[model samples]
Target: MADFFRLNKVLIFGVGLIGGSFAAALKAAGAVDEVVGFGRSLPGLEEALRLGLIDRIGESVAAEAPDADLVLLATPVGGMAVLMQALAPHLGPQTIVTDGGSTKHDVVANAYAAFGERVGQFVPAHPIAGAENSGPAAARADLYRDRKVVVTPLPENSSVAVARVCDAWRACGAVLHTLTPADHDRVFAAVSHLPHLLSFALVHDLAVRDDRDMFFTFAASGFRDFTRIAASHPEMWRDICLANRAALLDELDRYTAQLATLREALASGDGAALEAAFDSARTARRAWAEGKLV
Candidate 1:
């Protein structure tokens, strides 16, 4: 199917890491004939063009959206509503739209509002991969290789549309998975969102401290590893946290409760409790790294 399905011309709404990577991977695999990019700024698009990530910078949706095989909304979730409304009128009958938004429910809602009867054209997706750096220069053709891409298809989507989207991801060497938008938001809130939130919070807490420089100077591998995601694009993560607030708040409260337990253990000098909790986390982390727990 990967060999059978090919994109003649693809439109990318954001020429940053995710979208640039998609274009690069497709070009690398000889799967896409042409790639057009549209973004918040021309300089970014020009950078993507310079990097060979796109064939051209899109000037008008009306002119390019009609014949493009796919349109990828790779911007922050907060920008999707405006882009959806802009693209809906010019969107072609066969042009299937998909996204790399971390939160799916909000994306689906925006699609429903913009496309109405044509919501089937928009297939919601989230690629479970990224790096610390961003922009066109940071994009690599192998970024999505062996990574999981979760597609939360609306009931309005036809089998053919979903299959074609799946094939495109496979061409980028991604593994496909499916989930409902609600489930997708809920699951990622617990796993991905919570971790990023904690990472950001930990770094911020340290940064505001009077001895921040001292802490940073003494910080080592463990601190660097834990706070790596804190350096992620602030605007992007801000949109994700707000978009998935309900689920994220619930997970945050649960984490808070766990933190309380740890605080109590530390205050009471409960060595056994600390050891047990650390041991459990160590076991789980090792199991996950070994691919023994899925």
Candidate 2:
């Protein structure tokens, strides 16, 4: 069992789905004494408070960041740099800052540039859990339970800060995993990011076709499962695709080549090649299902 401590107060910025879920989890687990949500919108703050996601709502980042033991940035990836710049002047020396942003390399760099040696207080993290939904209303307290939470610590990051961040996630029922920012971004590009792009592209391609509605009406569970990620926030996915462009593009190219090879095999009536390929994929998928990937 992992040791857990009750944080004095945690300032969570942008209490949308991930943020709201995190707050709810902390509250449910009795891990935090206070959760102060900072958002520009009054309705969002009110909703979060009503949902019991936060103890109180702070009006501004400066006021909220200074008093927090932990500060979690849960906004979209593109907004991280701007948010970090805004919160930089107000962060307390003892505060451990972390994020639920999908991309790490850019976010880690931005944190370093904004805070310099104070970057040691920052631990960049991405929870490998979320839904195809947004806002407090869609959040659930148990959303992160048994989920993998990846913490990417830079060279400047303090071990104490990293451990604190890990403990916080553990308290929320998440299993902690450590990875370098570069490796995290690269691996996620193939396993997580690429699938999201493919889903969006597939749905877009189908929607644009002449018989889209007719085709969709006949679609089955497999289609729904394959395109579930397409329902994710467009702006967020757009930012992720652009942020992890290099790794995503490489994975996309590899996937396209594999698809082309399958098509060629079918056209050439190569039964043995098709069978071998299918068997290989089945074996790989079965291994994944059996928990061999971790």
Candidate 3:
């Protein structure tokens, strides 16, 4: 029941939120004919296959690589280097690979190490879309619709490979933008990684308190909104934080500096200084929200 059938066969590595969503989106759009999935859990892969997110369960990367027109490494960043090494040995000439790792520089480095001269076949991308929940059950075909996807293509990547990666994301209704991997990591550290870190830290702080139950009982919308991302996958975020630790640490330092400034303003009873800072942040946030597409 495919329409265009742009990809004869696609291989998915994780079969979780990002991977499941991609497969579902592509299937819904008739963009691909068959999807073969590889993952650590047999039950999870079975669920993905049962949900029609993928057609078959893939065994060996070497066995599957020759037939995969495209491969998506949707696993955590920590696992990427091994996956890259596995695929590098048997990839078809036309098989182009891309990943959903949040930290791009490390992923790009992993590709360089694994692919070497064939590194051009791997295009790096980060989809600016996620939900508190994960796994195949949490995936939906519309997850990436109108979402921003950053593609950090290597200099060695050919135009054709880059175009195909862009087109794949487009098929999921994502808006594509390009950046150097370093810039992508730095920007995401401030906007994405830092926020997740803060959210997780805040939740952890509350959970470890003596009056934790009381805090939970009285928590309201503001707390809920701020800590929503605390519900994200732990191992994935751990890898992201560690992989992009340098940039994340710098952003964290800057954030702590702002916190210190606010604390000083409060201690000095400088309502005006606090108000000025709050107003500036409010205005910038409003402007960003107004122009935001996702």
Show the lowest summed lDDT stretch of 10 residues, model 3.
1-10
lDDT of each: 0.93, 0.88, 0.92
Clashes of 1: 0
In candidate 3, residue 40 scores what lDDT?
94
What is the model-wide C-alpha lDDT for candidate 3?
0.92
Candidate 2: worst 10 consecutive residues by lDDT? 1-10
State which candidate has the highest lDDT. 1
Clashing pairs in 1: none
* Candidate 3 C-alpha RMSD relative to the actual structure: 2.6
lDDT of 1: 0.93
Measured with C-alpha atoms, the lDDT of residue 119 in candidate 1 is: 96
lDDT rank order: 1, 3, 2
Instruction: Write the residue-wise lDDT of candidate 1 on 102-212 in tens digits.
Output: 998888989999999999999999999888778999999999999999999999999989988899999999999999999999999998899999999999999999989
Indicate the worst ten consecutive residues by lDDT in candidate 1: 1-10
